[model samples]
Target chain A: MKKITVGFLALLFLMTLGGCKKKEKVKVIPPAEKQVAKTGEEVKEKPIPKPVVQEESIEDMSLEEINKKGYLQRIHFDFDKYNIREDQKPILIKNAEWLKAHPTVKILIEGHCDERGTEEYNLALGEKRAKAVRDFLISLGISPDRIKIVSYGKSRPLDPRHNEEAWAKNRRAEFVIIAK
Target chain B: MRKILIFMFLSLFSFSQQEITIRIKGGIPAIRIAVPPFIVRATTQQAISAAKEIEEAFRADLAFSRVFDPLSRDLIALVKDRNPEKPDLKAWESVGASVVFIGKVEEKGEYLRFVGKLYDARSKNFILGKSFYGKIKYRRLMAHRMGDELLKYFGQVPIFTTKIAFISDRDGNRELYIMDYDGMNQMRLTYTKGMEMLPAWSHNGEMIAYTSFRKGNPDLYIRHIYQGRDELVARGGSNITPDFSPDDKFLLYSSSLPGNYEIYIYNLRTKQRRRLTFSYGSDLTPKWSPDEEKILFSSDRSGSPQLYIMDSDGKNPRRITFQGSYNASPDWAPDGDRIIYVSRVLGRFNLYMLFLSTSQVIKLTSGMAMNENPCFSPDGRHIVFSSNRSGKYQIYIMDYDGKNLRQLTSKGNNLMPSWQKINYRR
Candidate 1:
């Protein structure tokens, strides 16, 4: 019963957010109406410039440029482990929220590992790490289509140094904005 | 001229069949053999130097075999057999050589011909003689053929001519490269400009199945090395760790296409694939058994990565490693009695050999460095693996008993070495 109530409230909040976006679209159209009135009395209003303004609300950014925004957080894993840590839950929640806000943004989660195990096993372990993150995101209501995962094994390390500190950084699932 | 022709014909027919068979068993000692410097009968400078190079390469192959005790340079200097056709066997025997090899390299226009004669020093009998003809550029290959001939005569698999395919980042990217068993002629095999890893050489040695990231994702690719063509085997969702079947008609690998990493077997001829494992845990590094009846793979279904064995059809799955919590990269030896794998204990990765019959596990390496991806040699006498004991990862070869360890590569971070598999008749 309490779960239903919470879900109902969440749906109401999403509806309210959608209502605000519609209001913003309404506000942008008045300027386009003023431009149409100034252009010609007999010309038909194409509304082409208005839709562009609304599309510009999300910012027409390249994949690399959008990824530089660092909206989604990279989650780190323990050595030789794929389970999400309790301390890292808050970071994933924030990332999930950001992903929820940007529904059209597609992400590629690259799972990585430390340079300890063999390449083949590490590749599998990296996939497990990525899947674990994807599962967590799914629990938080992120669509599966919005996220794709790849395991780089230990080939691409954030830090090339052979130490625990560097390994902790290397064993992470990095989020890349693939499409928007 | 007629006398010379007759002498040549007689020497060619002088090979005798020895009654005693030399088997390289555990208790038997390595046969003492003397290899005199090859007689160079070449007029050109290239051919003269090629003769000397071939001699050294052939001797190195013998030393690397670990089955023959090659005579030292000092012992070989004690006897000089100027005419390879007329070797002084008694002088070779005086230097404690049980067998002697007299080799002659002759340059014929654009090709080189190597004539090698093996003799029993005590009995003064020609045991066997072989002639290898090839271009001057294939000097090492011809030398390896001579070594292979000696190995075959002793009822052993010819491993001197086999190659080891591995991943090297020396060219700034991890690319597939193959080298001689002793690390000579390191040649890059792929120019995909993307990371290539986990190369598995086919049993016939005509193809190499490896994982590449050339298309932005790790995809399985089979490179027909000699033909200079590639066939994209699998794609979509991180395809990696391709192991060719014994007959080269199929490939077994792990892919993340079905929501998670799962073992899949694909028919190379028909291009059909079937999932072997249906588990949430990752199933990776699948290798075919010698007879192709079973498969040896690593799985994390039991909470941690462990070695697992199942039938070729993915039935009767069972875990084999219980001692270590982290056991992966299991390779079935050609003998079918032992398995070589990597196990991590207290963060240190080392190679371990498990006996399937007795269930006895022996540690093959002991160090603080990471020793991983160990594959058995074609003859199952040696293991090729990667290690970072020298501060950088390099390929190394060691005997099955863990002695006589030698480094095969010394370039930028070579890992995941797959020794070529050659089938031998029992």
Candidate 2:
């Protein structure tokens, strides 16, 4: 009876140790998997799958819904500049691909500016921004006839705050689906 | 020193009899004048009120000229008689005034008659006198006419009869409005729900050409202001910043039709459009030279926006501004000797005047909130621009050399001021 009690105690101790080891393994493996998931998200953010996701979401959604879902991303410009930045190229490519997937769609490109310049000059600058986007899409095999450009200049602002961040956001080109 | 003082006194006395001739010999000092309360010939309250308003309008007009120093009301009250045909010249001269303007208003049924006379205080004789008859509502116009006659006697251009057309968002939408040069008689000229901007008055002051987004696109429009009729001059692409030719036979504008903003001129009679610029960059805000032979416009063809001058035929496009990376909204002076424009320096916009003959640029505004859309007054000696220095965008008028800055607007975002050429016949 004494030997059997000692054996039971030993068995209980071993079982507790095993449970702790399992908990340790769980804690260890999760961070590694989290790292992998983070890297995977970074990989997904590349040019390849972005348009596919955009296309899938855009097909079933209305124009307002698409806009609400942010399927078409607004592209930003530098101060007093209309040239698209290199980092924005991939996004434009994704937009172009999405536009291509929907053959019957028409888009209007609205160019905007921060309230830092004269209204008339900003109008010209905004037009240039819209044209830059349209030209890029055209180069990516999208039809020019499907796109129309308008310059709101500094009249419309995405963010009304008077600061650098707000100005950066205000100076952007936005796409609105006119027809589908 | 006594001898020198005596000699100066003698010289001054020699020219005292010919004050007008002496005033013209050197830089004319602002003439000191007295404008007392006008005499009301009618007994009714409304008639008396109308006379008071006429006097006030006349005083404001003279003050706006910046060439007259109107005596204080306190000084004018010391005069015993304020009659237009009476002996107040001695009282005015005692107050250091060299000229005196006296006026009387009479109510004649539906019309008011205003008679104003300018007197040389030293001569105690009438220098000039004029009478104006107009509807009761045109009392201000009558006063302006009187002021113009006074200005003519001083060899200064009369601007009180001019008008200013500007863009205002007071009605929850940007629209064009015309007001008297002193900001009285504000009238809504365009009811288009969309944005209307960049108003340019025709040379004859009969029409106003502006850019409107009424049809969901920026297009050029010309309206016969008095006739209440408008026509679309250009559409289909971004057409903006329209200016009438000196002869009022053509409209110069900028369009983005060829996938880029370029200057274009459209003939009013034939409706023929001619492209003036073919650069890859944007060219906009074209202003006709006084002679209508050259066009001064802002162009970004050289990688940064700068002022450029091209012939009326769109030939020989040459850059005129090189000091700033951003220079735009060029208005050629009516005298055809200078150009006024806005330039961006250290991220703040300010007005600069370029003397065409010398290619010299002078900064007219400094440390004031962003000043822009500068247009020369009809005389080319003053400029009207919009500034936010007062914490809100308002139209301001300053001398050509940036003196006597006066705010012309106080409500809403008043911008893009276009001074109308005076039509004396009107």
Question: TM-scores, in order shown?
Answer: 0.83, 0.81
Q: TM-score winner among the candidates?
A: 1
Model 2 Cα shift for residue B119 (angstroms): 2.3
Query: Recovered native contacts in candidate 1, as a fraction?
Result: 0.88
- Tens digits of per-residue lDDT, candidate 1, A31-108, equal 756766787666553655424343433456777777787888888999888999998999999999888888888888
lDDT, candidate 2, B90-141, per-residue tens: 7789888888877889999878999977889988888888999998888888
Q: What fraction of the reference interface contacts is present in each model, in order?
A: 0.88, 0.69
Candidate 2 yields a Cα-based lDDT of 0.83
Overall local distance difference test of candidate 1: 0.87
Residue pairs with backbone overlap in model 2? none
| TM-score (chain A only) of candidate 1 | 0.68
Candidate 2 lDDT over residue span A119-167, tens digit each: 8889988988999999999999999999998998997889866678999
lDDT of 1 at B113: 98
